[model samples]
Target: MAATELKAQARTGVGKGAARALRREGLIPAVIYGDKKPPLPVSISYNEALKRIYAGGFLSHVITLDVDGEKHKVIPRDYQLDPVKDKPLHVDFLRVGAGARINVQVAVHFVGEDKSPGIKRGGVLNIVHHTLELSCPADAIPEQVTVDLAGLDIGDPIHLDAVQLPTGVQLHGHEIDPTVATIVAPSGMRAEEAEAGAAESAAPAGETKE
Candidate 1:
């Protein structure tokens, strides 16, 4: 996909009063920092900022910032929103340099649910992590991690090692391999299994429980 370009203007003021003044003018206060460079104070159109936030993967996708004719490669590090109106208040963008690998949380998508034998048998798909933190090339970040559920059986777990990730992307900050999801038996099936186990435990000398 083509990169998104956002236009911004260099701002000269600081403090709450100045920020409020910008907000009244339909602009959002923002700062671009990182990559060993001094922070650049800027303001963006409030409507444009809000629209990007409403769009999914705003934080994950790499974007270009056109600040007063100077272009910058950046990714949204964080942002603040108004509690009452849910409007964008401020934004923090991190500068992305060449060959830089940044950590980001990518959404998870499970596919082939109907093809999974366990799911067909009424087994529940229990998700452990809805998003996985990954470190990858700043320009090649993945939109989401897709997990294939075909042929998975009850009691089977979907582990991070089993899922295929996009090139240049790898799990970040994890010391041990993690389970993304698990297939669990249905309530009725679980009850039946428990009852059968109890009966087997009660039997002695190979004799069946009455």
Candidate 2:
């Protein structure tokens, strides 16, 4: 994915009061931390950050941190939001280079409908896992990982190997058991069992139902 261009400025204050004050001014308080440079406190315009993030794959966007007119490469490592208000509260910017590898949570996206023979025959497709943890270069990170469930059967288990990752992406869940999807028989299938039982039922030699 292409990197998103964003603008940010260095901050001179710290603490809740300072952060609140920045918010009141319609700005988001953030920090930039990297290997060689000291962590720098910065602030970005609230409206600008919201717009970029809402567009999708905002975390992978390389930001230009204009700290007193000095630009630094950074990516959003973490962010906090107000639960009720759903507003951006604070953001953490980690200094990174184009070659650096970072571990991030990539969203899970469904590619095809659960067309398993069992599901078509009144079975249900249940998904137990959502996002997956991956290690990839920040530049090549994907917004989501697509999971294909087209050929699965009722008893078929979609495991981690079933998922297709981007060129350089690697899943951390590979070592552990991977269960992406499961097919379950629907409630109506129970009626079929009952009917089969009745068909096999027989009356005693001399005793018959009216």
Instruction: Please list all clashing residue pairs in model 1, or write none if there are none.
Output: none
TM-score for candidate 2:
0.79
> Tens digits of per-residue lDDT for model 1 on 69-146?
999999999999999999999999999999999999899999999899999999999999998999988888888899
Alpha-carbon lDDT, every model: 0.93, 0.77
Top-scoring candidate (lDDT)? 1
Name the lDDT of candidate 2.
0.77
Candidate 1 has a TM-score of: 0.91
RMSD in Å for all candidates: 2.7, 4.5
lDDT of 2 by residue, 71-165 (tens): 77777888888899878888888887758888877777875564557667766777777777788887787878887767766677778787778
